[model samples]
Target chain A: MRPTVHDIAAAAGVSLATVDRVLNRRPGVRHVTREKVENAIREIGYVRDVAAANLAKGRTYPLVFILPASDNSFMHGLNDEVRAAIARSSVERTAIRTLEVPAFDPAALVKVLNELGEERPAGIALVATDAPEVRDVVDRLVKDGIPVVTLVSDLTGSQRHHYAGVDNIAAGRTAARLLGRFLGGAKGEIAVLAGSMLVRDHRERLEGFAAVIAAEFPSLSILPVIEGRDDPEMAHMLVADALSKKGDIIGVYSLGAGNRGLIRALKEKAVDRSLTVVAHELTTHTRAALLDGTIDAILNQDAGHEVRSAIRVLKAKADGLAVIEAQERIRLDIFLKDNLP
Target chain B: MRPTVHDIAAAAGVSLATVDRVLNRRPGVRHVTREKVENAIREIGYVRDVAAANLAKGRTYPLVFILPASDNSFMHGLNDEVRAAIARSSVERTAIRTLEVPAFDPAALVKVLNELGEERPAGIALVATDAPEVRDVVDRLVKDGIPVVTLVSDLTGSQRHHYAGVDNIAAGRTAARLLGRFLGGAKGEIAVLAGSMLVRDHRERLEGFAAVIAAEFPSLSILPVIEGRDDPEMAHMLVADALSKKGDIIGVYSLGAGNRGLIRALKEKAVDRSLTVVAHELTTHTRAALLDGTIDAILNQDAGHEVRSAIRVLKAKADGLAVIEAQERIRLDIFLKDNLP
Candidate 1:
C-alpha cells in the first residue's frame, strides 16, 4: 500500500488541513510548519494518488507552453503538435494554453516568465533562452511552487523539474561519427552551421561534434562555426560565404532548426549531393532536401513526443508524484531519407 | 457536463442495479436489458468518469502485455521498458503482467491469447503475429469484452482497438528514398533482407519500398527478397550467399531485426562500408555497426515508446475512454551514428 496525505499528516503531527495547505502550497501555513510537512512527506515517501486526488479535489492542472514565434516549417510543425495536445486536453482533464515569445530574445522570455509567475498556473513549459535573467525568472516560478519544465531548448542551472528534450551532446557526437565515416576517412574540411552559440543545445552539439572528430577522425578539420540564427536567409548567406571562402569543404553539419537556407546554398553552390550533409530536425524543407540528395541525414527530436512528455511531467509534478524517469526521457532521433518517419 | 450512469439508467427505463450489471458486464443482466442499457449509453454518449468511477469502485485495471521471447537487444530493451512501467503500477493504480511467447511462432501466440482470454484481464496488449489463428483468438477476446491492442506487429482485420507502432509503409518508402539518394542515383541492384513475409510489418515494408523504387527510382533494380526470420545465423548465411551470387549489389535494406547477421556478412565479404546499407532498430550491434561504417542508416521504432504507448492505450481502453491518437501514434525513428540518442 502507498502512503497518502493522511500518513504524511500523521507523521508530521499536523492536521490534515494543514498538510493539505503545505502540500498544495496554499497560503496561511507557517514556514516551520511547511518545512515539517515537507520533511514528513520526504520521509514517508508519500506519493499522491494523482488521478484519485485530483478527482476528490476537482483539480484540473492549468499548464502553459511557451514557444518561439517563428514561421519556419519546424516551428509550424511544433505548433501543430501542441495544438493537437490542446485538443486532447479536455479528455485528459487538463487546461493547456500556449504563449509565443520572440525567438532568441532573453528580455522577452524573462518578461513572459515573470508574467506567468504572477498568473501562477499549476505549471509552465517553455523553450527557454539561455540567459541569466530568464533563468532567474524560472527560479522564481519554482520558488513560488509552480512546476517548470523546459521543452526543446533548456535553461541550465535552474529549478526546472524536468527537461523534455533530447541529449544534444549525444546527438552531435552521433552526427560527427556519421559524417566522418560517410566521408570514407578522407582528409577534408567540415563546415558547421548553427542557430546561435548562445543556445545551450547548439553549443553542446558543437562540443560533442568537435570531441568526436578530434578523437576518432583526425583526418577531417572543422571550420569555424557559422551562426545562422536558424533563419533561412542567414543560413544560406553564411553557408554560401563559407563555401566560397573555403572551397575544400567535404561535409556540412547543420545543428539548427532551419534547413531551407542550407539547402538553397548547397543547390546554388552546386555542391555534389554526395558530400556528407547532416542537419537537425525533420520538417517539410528538410524532408524534401533529404529526399532530393541535398541533405544526407537529419537528427530529429519528435515534437509530438516532447509535447506529450511535457504534459505528463507537468501533471505528475502538479499532483505531487514522481514521474517514471525512463518513460519521460526523450530520445535523440536520427533520420536518413531511407528511414524518415 | 458529461452524463452519468444514473442518466443512462433513467433513459433506459432500467433500475440502477441492472444498469450497473450491464455496464460492468457482470453477467446477470438479461440480453434485452443489456441491449436497452447499451442503446441508452450510446444515445447519451455517457463517457464514464474513469478516475471517479475507479475510485468509487476501487477498481484497478489489470493489463497483460504479451511480448516475443527473443533474446535480442531490441527485445531486451522492450522488456526493460515494460518492466519500468510495471514497477510504476502500484503508484499508477494498475496491475500489469507480462507474458512472453516464443518468437515467430503463431501457434504459441494463439495459445497464449486463448489463455489470456480465459484469464480475462481488463485489457491485453500483444505483439501480434500475422496469422489467421492469432487474429481469430484476438477476435474472441474482443468479443468477450476485453480490449485488445496490437503492439509493434499488428494483426490486420482483427478487432484490435489500436496499433501502438510506426507505419511500416512509410518507413519503407523513407528507406527507399534514402538508399536511392545515398547511392548517388547510380543504377545498381539493391537487395532487401526481411524477417519474414508472413509478418504484416515486413510485407508492408516490402510493398512500400517497392512502391517508392518503382515510382521514383526506376533505374535501381531490386533483387529477390531474402527472409532471415530475424535470426543472426540465418541472416549472415543468406546475406553472404546473396552477396556471393550477386556481385553487383550496390545497396541493402534490412527491414527486419537481427542486424548482427547483416553486419557479419558485410564484414566477411570485406565489403566497403561506403555501400549503402539501411536496417531497422538501434540495438547495440546496429549502433556499433553504424558508427564503424558497416551500417549507413537505421530505421528505428523506439522499443521503449512502443511499450509505454501500449500500456497507455490499454489503460485508456480499459477505462472506456478515447485515447489521444496523436499522442499514441508511435514514430518511425531514423537513426545515424551522429544523431543517436
Candidate 2:
C-alpha cells in the first residue's frame, strides 16, 4: 500500500491537522513545523494522491498564458491551441486565462506581469521579450511562489521554472545546413527575413544561421536581415525589394512568421524553384507554396505541444509537484512538402 | 462559487451518506435513487472537484498502455513518450504500466488485451491491429467499464472511446501531392515501399497516394509495391533489386518504417540526389540522409504527440468526461532537411 498522510503525521510526530496544513502549504503553520513535515514526507517516500488531494482542497490551477497579438499564422495557431486548452478546462479542472499584449511590446507585457502578481495566479506562462523589466517581473513572480514558464521565445537567466519550446539555435543551424547542401556548392547571396531582432528566438536563429553559413559555406553571403515584424505586407515589400536590388540572390530564409507575405513576394517575382527558399511554420499558405515550389522547406514548433506543456508545468507548480524535464522538452519540427503533417 | 456535495445532497433530498455513495459510484444505492442524485448533479452542473474528491477517496488512475514491440525509431519515440508519462505518474496521481507485444502479432496482442481486462485498470491505451479478434477483445474491455483508447494505428468500427492518431488517408494524399508535384511534370516510374497491406495505415497511404497520382500526375507511373515488413534488411534488399531492374525510377515513396534500409539501398546504388524521395518519419537516419541530399522530403507523425494524446484521452474517458476534439487531433508533420527539427 502507498504511504498516506497518516504515516507522514506519525513520522513527523505532529498533529494530523498540522500535517495536512503543512502538506497543503496552507497558512498558520510555523516554518520549523513545515520543514519537519516536509522532511518527514521526503523520508517516507510519500507520493501525494494529487487527484484526491485536489478533490479535498477543491484546487483549480489558475494559469495565465501571455502571447503576442500578431495576426500571423504562427500566432493564430498558438492562440487556437490556447483556446482549445480553455475549452478543455472544465474537464481538466483548470482555470486558464490568456492575456494578449501587442507584439514586441515589452513594457506592456511587464506591466501585465506586475498586475498579475497581485492577482496571484498559481502560474504564469509567457513569450518573453529580452528586457530587464520583463525579467524583473518574472523574478518577482517566482519570489511570490508563482511558477513562471517561458513559451516560444525564452528569457535567459531568469527565475522562470521551465521553457516549453524548441531550440531556436539548433533550428537555425539545421536550416543553414539544409540550404548550403541543397544548393549543391553553388555560390550566391542569401537573404534573411525576420520578425524582429528584439525577440530572443529571432536573434538566436540569426546568430546560429550566420555562424553555420560562415563556417561551412564561406562562398555564400547573407545580406542584412529585413525586419518584417512578422507582418505579411512588410515581409512581402522587403523580400520583393531585396530580390530586385540583388539580382544574384540565390536563397531566401524567412525565419519568422508572415510567410503569406514572403510567398506573395516570391510569386510576384516568379522566383526560380532552384533558389532554395526556406521559411518557418507550416500553415495553409506555406503548405500550398511548398507544394507549388515557392518554398523548399519549413521549420515549425507545434503550438499545441507548447501550450500543453505550459499547462502541465503550471499545474505541477500550482500543486507543489515536480515536472518531468524530459517529457516537457519540446522538439522543433522540420517539414518538407513531401512530409507535411 | 462551485457547488459542493452538501448542495448536491440537499438538492437530491438524500442523506449525505447516500450522496457520498452515489458520488463515488459505489454500490448500495438503488437504481432510482442513483438517477435522482445524478439528475441533481446534472441540474446544478456540479463538476466533482477532482482534486478534493480524489483526496477524499484516495483514488488514483491506474492506466495500462499496450504498444507493439517494434525497434523502429517511431516505435522507440512512442515508447519514450510512454516512459515520460510514467515518470509523471507520481505527481499526476496516475499509475502507468506498459505492456509490449510482438509487432504485427494479432494473437499475442489479443491475449495481452484479454489479460489487461482481467486486471481491470481504470484505462487502457493500445495501438490496435486491423483484426476482428482484437476489436472483440477491446469491445469486451469497454463493456467491462474500462476506458479504452486506440493509439497510433486505430481499429475501425470498434467500441474504443478515442483514436489518437493522424488521418492516414489524408497523410497519404498529401504525400502523393508532394511527390507528384516535386517531380515537376517529369515522366518517370515511382517506386512505393510499404510495410504490409495488412496494416490499415499503410493501406490507406497507398490508396491516397494512388488516388492523387492518378488524378493529377498521370504522367508518372507507380511501380508495383514492394513489402519489406518494415524491416531494414528486407527493405534494403527489395529496393536494391528494384533499382537494378527498374533503372528509370525517378521517385520513391516509403509509406512505413525501415527507412534505414531505404537509405542503405539508395547510398549503395549511388542513386541520383535529384531523384525525388519521400518517406515517412524523421529519425536520426532520415535527418542525416536529408541533410546529405539522399532524401528530398519526409512526411511524419510526432509519436510523442500521439502518446500524450492517448494518455489525455484515456484519463478523460476514465473520468467520464469528454475531450476537446481539436486538441486531441494529431497532425501530419512534413520535414525536409532544410526544415528538419
Candidate 3:
C-alpha cells in the first residue's frame, strides 16, 4: 500500500495539519518543520493522489491562450486545436479562452499580456512575435508566478518556462539535406521561400538551411529568400516570378506555411522543369502535392500535439510538478506520401 | 460542476445501485435500465473520473507483455521500454509483467498464451509470430474477454483488438521510394536484407518494397533476400558475401534489424561503391551510419511510443473506453541525419 499523510506525520513527528501544509507547499509551516515533513515524505515514499486531491478541493485551472490573428492554414489549425481543448475543459478541470492579437504585432501582443496580469490566469501560451518588449512582458508574467510557454514561434532571450514546438533550425537543416541528396550532384540554384523574416522561427530555419547548404552541398547556391507573409496569392506571384526569371533553379525549399501557393507555382510553371521540391506543413494541399509528385517531402509539426503539450505543460507547472521531458517533446514529423497520417 | 453518479441516477430515474451497476458493467442490471443509465450519461455529459473511480476501488490493472527473445537492438529496445513501463506500474495502477518467448517459435508463443488464460490478466500485448496456432490462442483469449493487442510484428488474421505498430507495408513502400529516388535512374541491382521470412513484418516489407520498385523504378532490380535472423554476425557474413558476389548492386534496403552488421559490411567492402542505402529502426549504429553518410536514410518506428501506446490502449480496453485513434497511431518516423532526435 502507498504511504499517506499519517505515515508522513508519524515519521516527521509532526501533526497532520503541519504535514498537509508541507505537502501542499502552503506558506504557514516553518522552514525547519517543512523540511522535516519533506524528508519524512521522501523516506516514507509517500505519493500524493493529485487527481483525487484536486477533485476534493474543487480546483479548476483558468488558462488563457494568446494566438496570432494570422490568415494562414497553420494558425487556423492551431486555433482549432485550442478550441478542441476548450471543449474538454469541463472534464479536464480547465477554463480555457483564446485571445487573438494582430499577427506579428509585438506591441499588441505586449498589451494583451500586460492585461493578463490584472486578471491572471493559471497559465498562458502564445505564438511569440520575437520582440524585446514582448519578451520583457512574458518574463514579468513568469516572475509574477504564472506559467508561460511559447507556442509555434518562440520568443528570443526570454525566461519562458517551456516551448511547445519543433526545433525550427533542425527542420531547416533537414530540408536542406533532403533537397541536396534528392538533387544529387546537380549544380544549380535553389529557391528558398518563407512566411516572413521578422519571426524567429523563419530566421532560424533560413540560417540552418543556408549553413547546411554552404557546408555540404556547395554545388547548390540558394537564391534570395522571398517573403510571402503566409499569403497564398503573394506567395504564388513571388514564386512564379522567381521561377520564370531563373531557368537554372533546379530545386525549391519552402520553409513556411504558404504551401498552397508554392505547390501551385510548381505545378503550373515547373511541370516542364524537373525541379525537386521540399515544403513545410502537411495540410490538405501539401499532402496532395506530396502524393502527386509536385512536392518531395513535408516537414510537419502536429498541431494537436503542440496544443496538447502546451496544455499538459501548463497544468503541470500549475500543480508544481514536473513532466517527463521525453513524453512532452514535440517531435518533428517528416512526412512522405507513403507515411502520411 | 461535472455531473456525478447521483446526477446520473436522478436523470435516468434509477437507484444509485442501478447506476453503479450500469456504469461498471456489472451483470445484475436489466437491459432497459442499463440503456437508461447510458442515455442519461450522454445527455447530462457525466464523464467518469476514471482515476478517482479506480482509486476509490483500489483497482490495479494486471497486464502482460509478451516479446520475442531476439538478439537485436530493436527488440532489446522494445524490452527496455516495457521494463520502463513496468517501473511506473505503481503510479499508473498497473501490474505489468513481461514474458519472452523464443523468436519465430509459434508453438512457444502459443504455450505462453495458453498459460496466460489461467493467470487472467486484464490485458495482453504480444509481438505475434503470425502462425495459425498463435492466432487461435489469441482468438480464444479475446473470446474469454481478454483485451489483446499486437505489438511490433502483428498477427495475421487474428482477433486482436489493435496493432500498436506502424504499417509494415507502408514502411516497405517508403523504403523503396527513397532508394529509387536516390538511385536516380541508375540501372543496377538492389540488395535486400531481412531479419527472417518467418515474421510477418519482414515479409510484408519485402512485398511492398518489391511492388513499388517494379512499378516505379524499372531500372532497379532486387537481389535475393538474405535472412539474417537479426543476428549481427549472421547479417555481417551474409551481407558481405552478397556485396562480394554482386558488383552490380548499387543500392541496399535493410528492412529489418542487424543494421549494425549492414553498416560494418558497407564500410569494409563497399567503401569504394556509392550504394544508396535505406534501413529500418533507429539505433546507435544506424544513427551513426546516417550521420557519417554510410546510411542514406533511417526509417524508424519509435519503440518507446509503441510500448506507451500499447499500455494506453490496454488500459482503455480494460476500462471499456475508447482511445483517440490519431493520438495512438504509431507513425513511421523518417529520420535524416539532420533531423535526428
DockQ of each: 0.39, 0.27, 0.71
* B-chain TM-score of model 2: 0.94
In CAPRI terms, where does candidate 3 land? medium
How many steric overlaps does candidate 2 have? 23
Q: Write the per-residue lDDT of candidate 3 for residues A132-175, one digit (tens) a residue.
A: 99999999999999999999988988999999999999999999
TM-score: model 3, chain A: 0.97
Worst 10 residues of 2 chain A by lDDT: A332-341
Interface RMSD after interface superposition, model 3: 1.3
lDDT by residue for model 1 (A37-117), tens: 999999988777777877777777789999989777777888998898887666678889999999889999988888887
Flag the better candidate by lDDT, 1 or 3: 3
Return the top candidate by lDDT.
Answer: 3
CA error at residue B120 for candidate 1, angstroms: 3.9
lDDT of each: 0.85, 0.85, 0.91
**DockQ result, candidate 3:** 0.71
Work out the TM-score per prediction. Answer: 0.76, 0.79, 0.97
- B25: Cα error in model 2, Å: 7.4
TM-score of chain A of each: 0.85, 0.94, 0.97
